[model samples]
Target chain A: MSGATSRATTARDAHRTAHVVGRVLGVGVSLGVLVIVVGLVLMLLRHPGYTTGQVPLHALIGRHARFPVGIEGLVRALRHGSAAGVVLLGVVVILASPIVGAIVAAGGFLAARDLRIGVIALVVVLILLVATVAL
Target chain B: MPITPLLFILVLVLVAAVAGLLGSLVGLGGGVIVVPVLTLVFHVDIRLAVGASLVTVIATSATGASRLLRRDLVHLRLALFLAVATTLGAITGALVSRHVPTRVLFVLFAAVLGYSAVAMLRRRPEAAPRAGHSDAVANALGLNASAPVGEGGQVVHFEVRRSILGLVAMYGAGVVSALLGIGSGALNVPTMDVLMGVPLKVASATSSFMIGLTAAASAAIYLSRGQIDPLIAAPIAIGVLGGATLGARLLTSVNAVVVQRLFIVVLAVVAIEMLQKGFA
Candidate 1:
């Protein structure tokens, strides 16, 4: 192969490799978040205030498959619903945290030599996460 | 006997695993598959099921966006524009959806499916790079001129008008996504590729990239309304993200034509089922 062609091939190969490394790192982050979520759910279950409902998650979902009564009905149920929403939000953030972390980590990893891209990706993700939490 | 919580979790995991794998493989990201299964098999409330499905859409987008962005398949500027339009459309559509009968939404979905099927049949199997896109057009559209597709590869140029149309379609996609809880891939792919002249692969990847933003737009509304169940969304999102990663990996070896064809057929069948439910 010609030198230029060979160099181009190597560059593409490197790009692909870096891309895969970043994604694999991301998956690792997602798994870590999943673990943390499970732990928190377990802890929540052990607490005195919370108890497992009579129906499994699947059955509850199945039985309630109709459209919600409306905003007014939900408003009436707000006291209980809001409480659930707060806990639910926590579970979502915890479960989803690792995926975001991994994605940011992968960007940083790929940009290891390049400070700008690495810093920008990581900083942006950190900001988004913090913002999501604040909201 | 009632299924245990553990068993329900297992079922969710199984669905996610399958959806993730199939979604990545066929480019639908399995939200379409998961929505029906959750509703039909699990008997989850359509509203909550749709809500959960939207979360899966986010997972699919997140998993696909990072890699696709690096590959230059995701058109960031275009996506940003579409996101704005689609978000506006989503708010309008969601409000309208709430007041309209559920059957109307079902009828609209059937029409969308019919439109998408015809659009799919008309799409080119092999994406052809469009001719006549100049450097100025590329710069104007804010498309990345730095990385042109491979050496001597024609710089993929796009028309602003068609992209706007694609965005309009995406607005419709946002509404459909909010209503049905499926990733708007069925709508997005055709709009971008057939309508806007993006390559098939880029169209699919870009659609995936767009889903997160679109879902985020509506998820807030659902969250406020107390429609989001953390216990449900948590497991579903985790499963989808993991499954999509595996699916993207599997896409490397799969026969995409066959898979996509089968997917179109499955979509057709589902659309018919939905029509029955609507008209009946």
Candidate 2:
């Protein structure tokens, strides 16, 4: 009877481990997808073919278009633009990310009623946003 | 040609990693590390170096802030209120940077470094502790006027007036960040921790949280100048993030005294370099 119970406990623990591993992988995959999608979208938005005039990417959208964009063209345009709009747009993105990160974290906390974790996630999101911009 | 083959990527990553490690350990940013290296070692233009360095300061702040936020170490209420002032100050600073000569900016940078060294040397006298959320005081200092935030954990209260001083200090920090591309950690941490009576941990976290936004505000100006090099900023960001994670892990449960001493020495050297830049 004891031996049988131990086996059952081991099986339950294994199942829990597998579940956690899946969750971690899921989060990682989701973040990766988000980064890629954002990169692709920005690239399309700043495509050489997409120019409205001599404005280019930085002039049209903001300095965010110059944020390395995982491609060379966006960076080039950002480094070459001569408008105040670039700075204005960058300020907007810079200000917005933390709010977005906080709201998401707040929602998660509300769902779980775990304010501690929520605060932590909020901070994390802010940091990640800054890290992305600095990059 | 061929987008420069990202040759600077690995070098910048390594540089940023080192900066993050030292910055965390010594409470400074990779800017102190990146600026000289970019101009001296990598042969980047000085203007571009400054521009890229400013962007990385924002990155380091964002990375460290996130980790601290997770632990709920940041005084969100205080940070938000002060952020309003700091943001305004930062915008003003960026605008001012256009008017200041690079040589004068270097002199100003050196003065800030000297101030930080003096601050580090003086020990704070233990004083009567104060409340973090005094409604009257908070309102007077503009804390109550800030966007309210909710964070779970023990509601640690501190005095409000000092926090306002910290915000003012950050304004100076913002100017330095905009002018020099060096993150104002040297200034921000001391201001928040020592003057404001915030705990070292919270001060560090809050400073990290503030730096990025401040830097981002200034970086907008640089971006308009067409100076930010994606090749430099991208690698530095990724590298610093990874390196800071490792550094933070290593930092847990270590004696910080030695680190502080080393930081003073390094700052002094950097200060001398700034003086030279000014004179040059």
Candidate 3:
């Protein structure tokens, strides 16, 4: 292929990758935010006093607060139908979006025949996964 | 004024919205505003504030990048390449954060931010170079790309230079981000714009794109450690996502110089705040 043609192909591939990755991020974030908003509304309905009572913000965020932590705790909260669990699930989804996006980008690069960047993206994904589990 | 828990969350959401707007425009994670307000105004614990801010940063980055990506502003290859360095650095920082004397690190970071602000002020905007003008490393990585500017469809094609240096700097930025519980966009932007020769707007957008992955690394650690409070993170995530979406829409049309000035102001403010924290 001519230089110009090759450049155009590269640009097209990059554009396609961006489009797919952008869709992933947008969809993930929108869904996560929607879930979080629903969870917040549920929390309000479950505890109407939250609107009138003098419960300080610290009651929820303070050291002694009893909220779920980690994936196992989040799953337990969800199983028990906890409103906070729904919110935590949303947070987890939000955090997971970028990781999903990176994975998609890696696949896109590999499909485009860009081995170097594809491998680099894969490495990044591995590092992120390791950070999640090991750190 | 005794605010109820609901009212307090409402107020916090509003504050986070503003932080998200500015942070998205400047490629930051909005922690500079969220952290201080959550700790000082809301009087939340610092750990929770940082945790919330970290989550907010991810929201900002995801929302901002989603929009910027469609506009062809984010350099995906460069972002992914840099993420490798930054993600590893973030884990290292998270591990070392417990052993490090945070006060000294805060002071050192403050100095770095202060210097970056001045450096940004002194540097003039760079014109996009012609295609095929990049170094061997950049060429091999295909880091050169064109970005559409304004509504006129005027595209600015720029070359990436000294990418190896930019990668090293990004590693340091990730460490700083993890150690300070802040988005390291203040460092990422300059490193890309100055060292790598990317245009300011593209640099900012790409930094925003990369910060999400970088923050996610440490945010996971925070999540597992029970530092992330759902009540706090939920509101922040929602507000920041909304604000970031709006900011990303505004970024492509706004003047680059205006964006740079806003970032400089943010940098100066964060530097001063870090200095105070170091002393306190």
Best by DockQ: 3
Which parts of model 1 have CA positions greater than 4 angstroms off?
A1-36, A39-87, A90-135, B113-123, B132-141, B144-163
- Residue-level lDDT of model 2, residues B57-93, one tens digit each, is 7655665665555444555445544555555555566
Model 3, residue B101: C-alpha shift (Å): 4.8
lDDT of 2 at B159: 45
Docking class of 2: incorrect
Cα shift from native, residue A121, model 1 (Å): 15
Native contact recovery (fnat) for each candidate is 0.09, 0.01, 0.74
lDDT of 1 at A11: 38
A13-130 in candidate 3: lDDT tens per residue? 8888988898898888888888888888998899887888756555777778889998889999999999999999999998998999999999988988888888899999999888
Best by TM-score: 3
Which tens-of-lDDT digit does each residue in B134-204 have in candidate 1? Answer: 33333343332222443365454444335556657888887777776666777777776666666666667
lDDT of candidate 2 vs native? Answer: 0.54
**Tens digits of per-residue lDDT for model 3 on B14-67?**
878887777766555677677667765666766677677778888778877888
Candidate 2 residue lDDT tens string, A58-121:
3322334344332233444356652222322342343334444344434544344444434544
* Every model's DockQ: 0.12, 0.04, 0.58
Which candidate, 1 or 3, has the higher TM-score? 3
Give Cα distance to truth, residue B122, candidate 1, Å.
4.5
